[model samples]
Target: MTATVAATKAYDISGNVLKEDLRDIIYDISPMDTIFMTRAGRGTAKSTTHEWLTDTLAAVNAKNAAIEGDAFGAVARTLPSRLKNYTQIARKDFEVTGTAQKTSNAGMRELMAYHTAQASKEIKRDMEAGLLSDEPASAGTSVSARVAAGAEAWIYAPNHISVNQSAATTTAPVSGFATSPVTDGTATAFTSAGLNSMLQQAWSMGGEVDTILVGPTLYNTISAFTGIATRFRDVGSRQQAQIIGAADVYVSAFGSHNIVLSRWARATTVFCLDMSTWEVAYLRPFQTVDIAKVGDAERKALLAEYTLVAKSPMANTKATSMS
Candidate 1:
């Protein structure tokens, strides 16, 4: 009644298997909310054109009225000036090979989810960099031409006040709309008094600078400023030595400003902005496209066509050339 040896033996062909739960986790630290340009201004692009125009006017000055029964004196009519800037569209594409996904056996609904997020992050990173450029795009082989008329390209409009304590050389001004460039400072550090002075200057020009954008070093320096002291008392029965520290708002002679720590900001420069006067114009909102199939398993691209329109540099001033 015994069975054959072959019938009793079972072949182990498929090896040990473990459940493959795909936890597609991404650990890249990207600039998620660096859209400072759109934070304080209107973000509407009505036209489908590649370039957008903004009308500007100089501050109306107060003048003495004509004397009663005196000869009629004439005043110049205030005309609106136009500022033209080109829109920039950035794209990022990614493709996955057919075999790569086929061989990898994992419980995943979408294979291209990670790639899409990466492409979107990169496009946004580049946009933040472009927004902080010192020179607006010029008419060249690669860049667009300067804005028409006397308007400074958006880049030139921001305050570029140099605070170099050393003998810094000056460079030719890029446009009549921009300030002349100065060499970096040889000084060691930035002082609180210096920041106060800059704020005062902007205040004198009727600018309510409500935001102070600074780099890491400057942010740390400001946080440690003696002028910004914290005096709070804990009234619990069991008092714990909790170190509560943060410098969110800075009160200056001009106005109170929120602090923004930026890693993308240029070295030796700090921007003080009113926020109400800045704008981001978008010809086309961000979109993803599926190109015609050529040879890839799956392909997609992300795009954002946008431009920065600074309403007036007078509303924003920067302290530059500080070490």
Candidate 2:
């Protein structure tokens, strides 16, 4: 190909006037689902140290019959055991320069506004992970931050099951509000046997297990289990056929459980929970506030102070050491 002699070309010109072809929307693929947080109940906490009480009735005795017309005798009444957890503060903040705030952006009008929205989602993800973690509770000092025990910490004794751990044993927290699983042992595949055993234990303790939370790897393994309830979906003749490959609800001798995939759940653990027995106690609800300007920049913070409440630890179970 040949061009005309001394012809002006677009590339030959400098500082050409042309509009940029930038999209108006921003695409973010980060996950934002908070399964545990959304499913758990909500409550209010008045102090940094949130407290709750749990009581149990006396075990059934076949010889509980008393002699007819016997004189009444005073018996000591059992009192509830108190449990407490420290409230933790989670926060996310961002700052925008004065010039950046005033400058035009491709996808958003103001940078600060977009960052504030992002902070909210980030904090939520953090809370979800924390609530499901094995971190122990701590009554922090001025230098250290307080920490609330998580669901894994509350599960103990009969409710806690060890999978393929080296010692075939799991440690329980000293108290419902302090300490955590001392060891994770070894990792292995999640099995139906482990799951059923935990469910049975929880049921024996009067737990009404209704939900099962698992990570991605375990989620897929659970779907392949033979025990999953059979699912049949009705389809119209004209409509395309649908393939059902995943298991959403698992039915066992104990009860039917809703199987949920958690993006932030621990890879080696699964939680069998009675939603009614769990709560998120908030001393201070989520709030956004503007920080005082230091220079020619605007600052903002997203803050929340909350604690995990295991209303009835016996009503929940944890399966650990699953790779």
Candidate 3:
């Protein structure tokens, strides 16, 4: 598939080059991968790089849309929103602390906490069991309680993109991911002969997708090409949902028979081929480490621990943003 544009930047030896820069390459790792995470952290913290990234995403999206003649607004709105949400959530969690029966995450004064506190004050029945009692028909766990208690209310937001299924087997694939299919033009859909054509066009431009998520509609479309749809149905009947480090959306397409393909996306963690360096494994819902049962502390720790990243910024590489 087409190589992403950003990856083609000529080696910038302007940065500090060791006097003895003998450049012994690390096994199974990218040159930038060894430095981007730290660099990006430095970059984002600087504010300029972060602004550049937001703008770059916008420019790229606009250009892509212009060429395809599709509405760029969908992706334009999506990119900023996604980036803001990710950064905001990460920031809040990064500075959280709690102790004893009391707890505080982010700023306690945020108002969400106030409503929760108010609701808890009203939880007067069956303190020993620690579960909500069947005492009154008035109170419930719904957000309405918080709203009545003066908490602001908002709808449950929907994610813009979905992660397709790809085995998280040794490690979650991270690099050479969205690297494929870097073409600016867009095809309305990919199916039967159409997908092959898309792949060919992508190859003409460079490399394409490393993994993908396929809904039943798209799954059946790809199945006709791969011929593995029947094999998938015979054994794994339920959609083996994976809590991919990369995906924002859940693979709700359950059942082995009815399901056609897995939801996969670009990588969420550093896609290191060297398994030894990364002992951490991809998380699924009910695996040895089910993300579902994890408490806030555990979840934060989990995220901090396994968020494998190259030393430099992945943004330097073109990241795929779905519209």
Candidate 4:
């Protein structure tokens, strides 16, 4: 009898079902894994509890930054079902790395691991280098960066950040926070084809995307699709009806949703924990991810995404004594 050899890592079947799983992953992200700000008056509700996320997003990545590509400014507003398409962007540039449930390894899971590895590397490299506004030190090298602290693009960028040997002016989490003039993105005409197009654009860039900020109308349109699980397809009457049925988990999360989320100031920033949705446990301002000047371009790459790398480190900067 021949023994069947198994692959150490597996993936989540890479299709529509995997797409649903991806949405679950994001949804399952479980809101920052740590201490969160509460609505001032009540002080009871744990809204965006980003436990150690303060450090993760502040973390960095390893995938070589492509100069001719998006260069880190590749955020998009699209439907949730389209998450799968955006993942393929890392095929050549970076790969993910992570741990698992010890027993179960699936196809989609393998893919996720690759993405994680890339993210971790990015965080490590960025942390050591001061956050700067430039292309990663290298153009298309295979070296991954670490997670550190500083801000190039914000929102997802860590709140407590410094620039060019400057002072830090990190953003605080929004409790009763509200954007000045809430303007909506392309939320009016959400078509099935449009969602797919948008997802493809993001994936082709670099899996550097962390969140998809959208308006209520756009959120409604995305939440309206389901059934096929994670894949994105044309939404017809019957399809939307089926997809809407499977959105119970997602819809429930948004039940308490208000119009305030959509009102983010175009220029104003929001506080974000830097660690992964999971790493909320061991985050400090200058811990884990650290920044250093190794050489020329290598250090330059590290500097490009500082806030991304340092969100979790708890470096020299001190957290406002939550007294």
Candidate 4: where is the Cα deviation over 4 Å? 1-187, 208-217, 226-323
lDDT of each: 0.60, 0.86, 0.23, 0.26
Worst 10 residues of 1 by lDDT: 146-155
Ranking by TM-score: 2, 1, 3, 4
Instruction: Give all candidate RMSDs, comma-separated.
Output: 6.7, 2.0, 26.8, 24.1
lDDT of 4 by residue, 5-94 (tens): 574323535543454433323222322211111111111112111111232132256885677855566665442211000000111133
Candidate 2 accuracy as lDDT = 0.86
Weakest lDDT window of 10 consecutive positions for candidate 2? 167-176
- How many Å off is the CA of 212 in candidate 2? 0.7
Model 2, which residues run further than 4 Å from truth?
1-15, 164-176, 230-232
Q: How accurate is candidate 3 locally (lDDT)?
A: 0.23
lDDT of 1 at 53: 34
The candidate that wins on TM-score is: 2
Rate residue 157 of model 1 by lDDT: 24
- Candidate no. 1 TM-score: 0.74
Model 3 regions lying over 4 Å from their true place: 1-190, 226-323
- Could you say which candidate leads in lDDT? 2
